[model samples]
Target: MTLKLELEQYPFVDLSAKVAEIIEDRFAIVLKSKLTLACMYLDPRFQCALDENEKKIAKSYLVKLHERMEIKRLAKLDASPDTDSRSNESDNSNTRDENENLLEKMLQSKCNQAKNSHQKKILQLLNEFDFQSERTPTGIDIIEFWTNNAASRLELAKLAAVLFAIPAAEVICERDFSTLNFVYNKLRNKLNDESLQCIMFIKSNEEIFQMQ
Candidate 1:
C-alpha cells in the first residue's frame, strides 16, 4: 500500500510523534489540491513566514500558558474555605467574656445605684419640690446642701457642659477622596494604562518622585 497506509498501522509509533503526525495526517490532502482555493483566499506572506509545526508550537505554548494562568485563577477563586476557623471561636470567646464581665459589673453598679436611688428618694422627700415651677428660688442652697457645703463646689461652679467635644473632628481623609473623585471623573476612559499608573504614583508619593 502507500507510505501513509503503512504508517497508519504503526499507530503506536505515530502516537509518539503526536502533534507532528496529526498535522501531516490532517493537512496532507488539503495541502495538495485545496492549495488553489486558499491561494488568494488567505494571506500567503503570513502563512509562508511560519511552517505548520512552528505555528502549532506557538499556539501550544500560548494555550498551555493560558491554561496554567486559568488554573491558578480557579485555584484562588474556588478553593474550599479554611477549616481552621478562628474568627468564630474568637468572637464567641469575646462574647462569653464580655457577658460574664458585664454581668459582674452590672451587679456591682446596681448596688451603688440602689444606694444612690435611696439617697435621692430621701433627699426628694426632705426638699420642698415644686414640679410645676421651672426655677428653684434657692438653686445653690439645694446643691450646697447635697454636697454638705464642700470647699470644692459643683453647684458653686457654673460649668455649662455642652456635650460636643470639638470644632468637628477635622477628617482630611474623605476630603482627599472627594478631590480625587473629581480627578477620576476627568480620566474615566481618556487615559491608557501608563498614565493612570503614573498619576496614582504621583498622588500617593509626591515627595518621593519630586526633588525640589
Candidate 2:
C-alpha cells in the first residue's frame, strides 16, 4: 500500500502506471516466496507491527507451506530403508515423548477451556506481545524468544532458521565491495584473500563483538 501510494505521487502518471504494473507482476512472485513468508511469520517484530488482516494473509500461506512440508517429510519417510531393531527403538522413544506432549497440551487446554485454532493462537500471541515497548526498554530478544519456544513451536523454529539463513537483500554484496575498497586501499594491497575475509568479517559484525 505504501509502495502504491508512493507510485501514485509520481508526476508522470504514464511512467508511474508502467512501474506499478511491473511492481505488481514482481510482487506476485515475492508473495509466493516461502522463505520471506516464513521470516515474516516468525519474526516477533513483524508479528507485532503487521495489522490483523496482514497476519491472516501470512498465516494462510504459512499453513499451506507447513502442509507442503509435511507431505515432503512423509515422502522422505516412505523412501527411507526399512527400520531395524535400533531404529524401531528410536521410533518408540519418539512416540512416547509425543504422547507425553499430547497429554500435557490436553491438560493445559482443559484448564484454559477454550482452545483457539492454530491460526488464531499464533495471531493472539503475536498481538498480545508488547514487542515495541520491550524493544525501547531492552533490545529485542527475538532469537532468545524463538529459541525458548522452539520445542513447542518446532515447525516455526525450523522456518525461522531457514528464513534467517536467506540474505535479506542483494545490497549486502555491494556493501561488501565497498568494505573491500576501504580495507584494500593502497597501503593494504598486500592483504591476501584469507586476510581480507578475516577483516571483512570483523568489520561487518564489529558492533556485535563490541557489544559483548
Candidate 3:
C-alpha cells in the first residue's frame, strides 16, 4: 500500500514542477519584449523587479524613444512658417563684422555644451539607485507620479506616456472587433471601406472628441 501511494503522488509532484517551469518561461518571454521591460522600469512599483541587464535594455529603449520624439518635434518646428522667418533673419545676420561672428560662435558652443550636459543628466538619472529604494511608496499611480514629479524630465514623461499607453493584453483588440460587428452589421454592410475606416477611427477616439 505504501509503494502504491508513492506512485500515485509521484505524477502530481512532477506536474507541479512542470507547471512552475512553464510559468517562469512565460515570464522570461514577456520580459524579453523591450517595450514591456521599459514600461516596467518606468513604473516605480516594479522598478526593482528588473535585473541589471534588463535595466540597461529598458533604459536604452526609453532613450531611443525620447530621441525619436525629439526628432519629430524638431522636424515640425522646422516646417513651421516661423522657421522660414528665422532662417531669413539668420541669413541677414550673417553679414555682421568678425567680432559679431565670433560672439555668435561662442554662444552656439555654449548651447551645445548645455545640451550635452542635459543629456548626461538624463543618463545619470536612469542609472540612479534611489528610485528602487524602499522609500518609494506602495500602490502609487504610475501616470500621476510621472506627471507630477517628472516635469523637469519631460523626455521621461513623454516616454512614460507612450509606454503606458500600450495595451498589455488583447482585451482592447477584442473590444474593437466587437464594436466593429455592431457598427458594420447586416443592415450596414453597404458601408464603403473609407467610410467604415472613418467611423472606426472616430469610435476608437470618442473620448477625445467628447472632451472637446
Candidate whose TM-score is highest: 3
lDDT for each residue of candidate 2 in 48-134, tens digit (9 for 90 to 100)? 544555556666666565556655876998786665855776658978788879999998887455323544554454444324434
For model 1, what is the error of residue 135's alpha carbon versus the real structure, in angstroms, after optimal superposition?
Answer: 99
Total backbone clashes of candidate 1, pairs 3 or more residues apart or in separate chains: 0
Report backbone clashes per prediction. 0, 0, 0
lDDT tens digits, residue span 1-212, model 3: 23444445555687655665666677779889998888888887777888888898988887677767776887998775766656777566756566678989998899778667766766776666336555456678888888896767666777788888888789999989998999999999999999999999999889999999
lDDT, candidate 1, 1-212, per-residue tens = 14556566667775645744765766655444332222211222233433455444433333333344544767999687866664676658877788879898997799678656644543332222212224334324333433453333321121101111112235645655665576578548676778766776577557677865
Candidate 3 stretches with Cα past 4 Å from truth are: 1-20, 81-119, 128-130, 135-138, 189-198, 201-212
Residue 182, candidate 1: alpha-carbon lDDT: 62
Ranked by lDDT, top first: 3, 2, 1
Angstrom error at residue 106, model 1: 56
Question: Candidate 3 overall Cα lDDT vs. reference?
Answer: 0.77
* CA lDDT, candidate 2, residue 170: 85
Q: 2 or 3: which has the higher lDDT?
A: 3
Q: Name the lDDT value of residue 59 in candidate 3.
A: 84
lDDT by candidate, in order shown: 0.45, 0.67, 0.77
- Cα-lDDT of candidate 1: 0.45
- Candidate 3, residue 64: how far the Cα is off, in Å: 0.9
